[model samples]
Target: MKNIIENLKEYALETIEAEAEAVSQLPGIVDDGFGEAVALMARCKGRIVVSGVGKSAVIAQKMVATLNSTGTCALFMHSADAVHGDLGMIGPGDIVLFISKSGNTEEVKRLLPFVKKMGNPVVSIVSNRDSFLGTHSDRLIYVPMEREACPNNLAPTTSTTLHLVVCDAIAMALSRFKNFTAEDFGRFHPGGSLGKRLYMRVEDVFDKTNQPRVSEDETIKNVLITISSHRLGATVVLGPDGDLRGIITNGDVRRMVENGKDINTLQAKDIMSRSPKTVDKSALAVDALRMMEANNITSVVVLDGGKYAGLIHIHDIMREGIQ
Candidate 1:
């Protein structure tokens, strides 16, 4: 079974090669029609109505999503739904982009009457530039590829990738035109993981119970108690005047063994990390995790407005997974 699996996995390499070739062919097809499509979308006052059926339907939905996130207003109207009176989604001065690999999908053709009646420019994405939808469109963008990534060469793998890549290109062009930012992307995807990653701040993922501290005059036993109570293997140490001095950790206590100092007699200031890695409480948790990994530290001391606030351990980072 293992041998058979290894042989079968070789097909994945073939699929990758095909996908790369498909993407490489995309640049040659971009020309005046591409510029016209961008210009139409940029100037249109109404929404961009994107319609497709079958596998093309999936690509159309993603394209519309990318468009909406990158400053172009777009609505995905399913072709089956369009024929069933969903054509009302399109308004005058709008632009329609219809997607079909063969340019003759039965459901896709059903949307033509509404497209014609809307009095908007029609743009078609198809393999055959002379097919029905292609001939009717004001402009046509041809994918021109003749193969698929599947072993049978029948699946929509390569063509769908091309569709999405072209969609992303158009969206990024609009993003440059409008200066779309990360905050802008957050507006359209407020309910998903990417949205949270974009907007959720460090304060949202910070540990609230930061009750672990040891004074500079605190005994070694008291420092141990602070470390155990915090469960972070460390604690912040403060000077007699109540200002931050350094940090005390288990490793710091262990070093006393070599110096012949008594654990219970020593003060926290005798052994502590003076220059601890500090992070702002307002930074993203994901970024904090990266900092911990880069510095090879298990925890970080968090500060609020330049004041000691809390400590975050590596476990807290994983359990929260970037709020």
Candidate 2:
């Protein structure tokens, strides 16, 4: 058992070293050909139809997803399925991109003739530029590799990594060329935590109906009742004509009690904090969270056009997974 465990570590290290070495050679392959391929896709008026077989087919789907998410339109067509009937998804202006380790897969070879018959421009990522798929392509992005990470040089390990990296490079290049911004990314991914951080405003997350406030001359007993009833841990003190005055929190009440102050003799104005942290209702929720974290407070006053609208608690931001 010890012998097997020791050999496992050695084999794993060898695999990693071999794959890293192959990846190190990828930069040299990104020459004029790579740029041309990216430019061709950028100029394409329609979606990028990426097709492959076996492990390459899985990588092709991932490429399609990345391209679509990064502002480039793309579709995945399995080479085996394309020949069977999926070729109908290809449009006239669409560009056909083929991924292959050998560039000579029988399924892709069979599918290529039909793609050519449709008069679509063909782009290929392949290790062997002389193979059928590479030789026949209109644009070629060559990815040369020493060997697979597989001990027998059969599994699609290092080669697939090279293919995926090349696809990502192409997607990122196109994204930059199109000037795709974080706002655009947020639009594409609206349901995730990342999207919420980028676009969710304080108005969207804070409770609107829970605007707990009290008059400055109100008794301290009522201020405690307001804070307790609203369950916000704090209350805003407003003056006549609804102008902002001050704020009182549970901590203030605790301190007053500890100091043995005459609770009955005081009003809201006497015990309230003169200044409190606040955020604009239109500001991003993530920004509000930052303010809360920086101030070491659990809530902040939400202002709408300089008027107190509501309170945004740290719990509210946390509930939305905006952190």
Candidate 3:
């Protein structure tokens, strides 16, 4: 058992080192061809049709997703399927990007002729520049590798990593060329937590129906009731003319009791914290979270146009998966 564990660890370390070495060689591979491929894709009038066979096909799908998310229109078509009716998905204005390690896969070889006859620009990420796919491509992004990370050197291990990295590089280059901003990314990823953080404001998360408040002269029992009813752990204290005054929390009640003070004789203003943390209702929810974290508080008073609005709690922000 000990020998088996030791061998597994050694093999893992060797695989990591081999892949890292192969990836380090990529900087030298980024010549004028890579730049030309980026420019071609950036200027493409239609979607980028990324196609590959075997493990390269999987990387091609990931490339499509990255491109679409980063402001580029892209789609994936399996090289094997492209020989069938799937070839119709490629439009006249689209660019075809083929990924392969040996540059001579049977499916890629079969599909290359059809893609070339369609008059679409062909870009390839290949290791063997002399092979069929590499020689037929209009622009070749060569990824020269020594061997795979597999012990038998048969599996698509290091080569796929190189392919994925190159695809990511191309996507980022196109993204930068188009000046894609985070706001644009947020538009693309509106349903995820990332989009919520980028666009969700305090008004979106704060409860408008549960604005707990109490008069400054209200009894401690009524203040406690307001805080308990709202379930926000705190309540705002309003002045005589309904102006913002201070805040009272369950902790304040507990401290008042712990001090052996007569809680029944005290009013809301007597035990409330005069200086409370506050946030504008129009502010971002992430900013509210930052305020809560910095002050070590669980909630903050929400103000709308310099007037008392409501309370925003940490759990409210957390419930929406906004850090």
lDDT of each prediction vs. the true structure?
A: 0.82, 0.93, 0.93
* Worst window of 10 by summed lDDT in candidate 2: 21-30
TM-score list, all predictions: 0.86, 0.95, 0.96
> Model 2, residue 249: what's the lDDT?
92
Candidate order by TM-score, decreasing, is 3, 2, 1
Per-residue lDDT of 1-323 in model 1, one digit per residue for the tens? 99889887887888989899889989988899888877777787888888898889999999998888778889998988887888877888789989888898878777786688768888888888878888888878888887889878899999899988888888898788888888778777776667656775566766767647888888888888889987888899876665678887777777787778887767888888889888888887777878889988778888888878888777776664453
Off by over 4 Å in 3: none
Give lDDT tens digits, candidate 2, residues 69-183: 8899999999999977899999989999999999999999999999999999999999998999989999999998878999888999999999998888889999999999998
> Any runs in candidate 2 off by more than 4 Å, and if so which?
1-7
The clash numbers for all candidates, in the given order, read: 0, 0, 0
Q: State the displacement of the C-alpha of residue 8, model 1, in Å, after optimal TM-score superposition.
A: 4.2
